[model samples]
Every structure is written in C-alpha cells, then in structure tokens.
Target: MSTFHLKIIAYDKIFYDDEAASVVLPAIDGEVQILTNHEECVVALKTGEVRIGTPKGEMIPAVCGSGFAEVTSDNQVEILVDTIERPEEIDIRRAKEAKERAEERLLQHKSRMEYYRNTTSLARAMARLKEANKYRH
Candidate 1:
C-alpha cells in the first residue's frame, strides 16, 4: 500500500512522525479516514480515538483531545491536538478520577464556558479510559 508523511503533534510533544499507510481521525463531523494522496483539506477533531495504520501494517491506536488536522497538497498530513496518548500510556485510575471531577463540576452549574469546558474534559477522560480498557492486557 502507498504511504504518506504523517506527523502528529500534541501540545507537549511530537507524538508521531513517519510514513503512514493511513489514519482514521475523530473529526467533528465523524470519523475521517485519510489514505495516501488524500484530498488536501483541514478538519476539526474532537476528543476520541485516533487509529494510525503504519507502513508495516501495524495499527497504532491513540486517544486525543480536541484539535485539528491539516492535509497539505504534498501528501503530508499534520495533526495538532491538545493531548494525545496511547492506550498503554493512559492511567485508568487517573482518567476515572478526572471523569468524576468533571461530573461533579457539571452538577454545580456555572458559566457557559465552564460548562463547555467540563463537558469536554469529561469526554476526553471517557475516551482515554475506554481506549485503555479496550487494549488492556
């Protein structure tokens, strides 16, 4: 299969940089798959799972926070997200605690911005937990 340059950058570090056969992203509208020579465009991402298909046919999975992806005309794909972590890297206990905190915050009610923030936090925590459990040994 053909491949393209895929670079995934989290706020703290570069999560991935190499040739990829494909990538399935959690776009705002829905899951978007990008293969080699995919159309040049940009898409908003939500807190969810990211599946990266490597040139060697391995599928690397990750959970990512909200952000965006840009596909350049040169067949290069770049994903910039607030956070990204592999299932093995996720701490289930920490994610569960974050979810509980977000739920508590939501129950208190606050400004619209605060509510939105809490909801996003909850979503990210849930995504992380789900991915981690799915791949748990």
Candidate 2:
C-alpha cells in the first residue's frame, strides 16, 4: 500500500509525524481527502475534525483549530494549527466548562465580535466533545 509522511504541528508542539495511508482535513470550504502522491497544494483549514488513516489501518482522529495545510510534491503533508488535540487528550470537564461559558456569552449577544467569538468557542468545544465521545472505549 502507498503511504506518505504526515506531520501535524500545533502552536505548542508537534502533534504527529508518521506515514499515513490517507488523510482527511477539515478545510474552510469542506473536508478534503488526500492520498499518497496527491497534487501539491495549500489550504486553509477550519475548526473541525481531522482523520488520519495509518498504514496499519488505524484511524486517528483529532480536533484542530483554524489553521493551514500544505502538501508537498514529495508526498509530505504539514498541518499548522493554533491547537490540535486527540480524542484521548481532551478533558471532558474542561470542554463542558468552555461550552457553558460560550453559551453564556451567546445569551448576552452584546456585539458582533463577542457573538462570533462565543460561537466559535462553542463550536470548538462541541467538536472536541463529539470527537472524544466517538473514540471513547
């Protein structure tokens, strides 16, 4: 099976670096799937889920904040994001608290900036919670 190197880096540290069979990224427009030898490209990523399929058939799921992705002709993919967290790394209690805070901010609805900020936070928290639940054993 063909595979390519995938490196995921967040603000604090490197999330992953390994060979993968396929990668599905959450782009601003939609989800984009990349395979080995995919054409070189750059894309802006949205805050959502990223699924990486390993050569051994393991699917690694992660929640990524808005960022960018670059694919090289040499079959190396680099993902740069503000934050990335695997399902197991997510703290459910923290996520719930964040969700509640965002909800409270939304209820206020004072300004557009505040509204969007809160909404984005809510979405991110929800995405993390969903991913964590999905992979929970």
Candidate 3:
C-alpha cells in the first residue's frame, strides 16, 4: 500500500510525525481526505478531529484547533495548528470547566468582541471534550 509522511505540529510541540496510509482532516470548509501523491494544495483548518491511518493499520486521532494544512505533490503532508491534543492527554474536567467559563462570559459580556471570543472559546472547549470522550474506550 502507498503511504505518505505526515507531520502535525502545534505552537509548542510536534503532535505526530510518521508514515500514514491516509488522513482525514477537518478543513475550514469541510472534511478533507488525503492519500499518497494526491495533490499539492493548502487549506485552512477548523477546530475538529483529525484521523490518521498508519501503515500498520492503526488509527490515530487528534483534536486540532484552527490552523492550516499543506499537501505536497510528493506525498508530504504538514499540518500546523494553534493547538493539538490526543484523547488520552486531554483532561475532561478541565475542558468542562473551560466550557462553563466561556458560557458564563458569553452571558455576562454585552460587547460584541467579548461575545465572539467567548463563543469561540466555548466551541473549542466543547470540541475538545467531545473528541476526548469519543476515544475514552
């Protein structure tokens, strides 16, 4: 089977670096599937889950914040995101607290700017919690 090298990096760390048979990323517009030597392109990423299929047939899943992905014609895929976390690494309690805080802020803040920030935070926290729980088994 054909495979490609995939590197996923965040601001503070490298989340993954390995050979993958395929990858499904949450693009800003929608979900995108990438395979070996697919194409050369760049796309914005939304806050969601990224699923990677390894050569050994293992599936690795990660939660990613907003970012971008670059795909090369030579089968190199680089994903740079604001934040990335594995399911096991995430603290469900912390994510829940963050979500509550954001919700509180959303209710108390009347300014549009504050509302937007709180809304985004709430969305991100919810995404993290949901993704983390999905892999708890």
* Model 1 backbone overlap count: 0
TM-score for each model: 0.98, 0.93, 0.94
| lDDT of each residue in 1-137, candidate 2, tens digit only | 89999999999999999999998999989999999999999999988999999999999999999999999999999999999999999999999999999999899969999899899899899999999999998
Error of 2 at 110 (Å): 2.5
Residue pairs clashing, model 2: none
The candidate that achieves the highest TM-score relative to the unseen native structure: 1
* Model 2 root-mean-square deviation: 1.2
lDDT of the structure predicted as candidate 3: 0.92
Full candidate order by TM-score, most accurate first: 1, 3, 2
- For 12-129, candidate 3 gives per-residue lDDT tens digits of 9998998999999999788999999988999899889999999998999989999999999888999999999988999999999999999999989689998988888998899999
Check candidate 3 and list the clashing pairs: none
lDDT, model 2: 0.94
lDDT of each: 0.97, 0.94, 0.92
Off by over 4 Å in 1: none
The regions of model 2 sitting more than 4 angstroms off are none
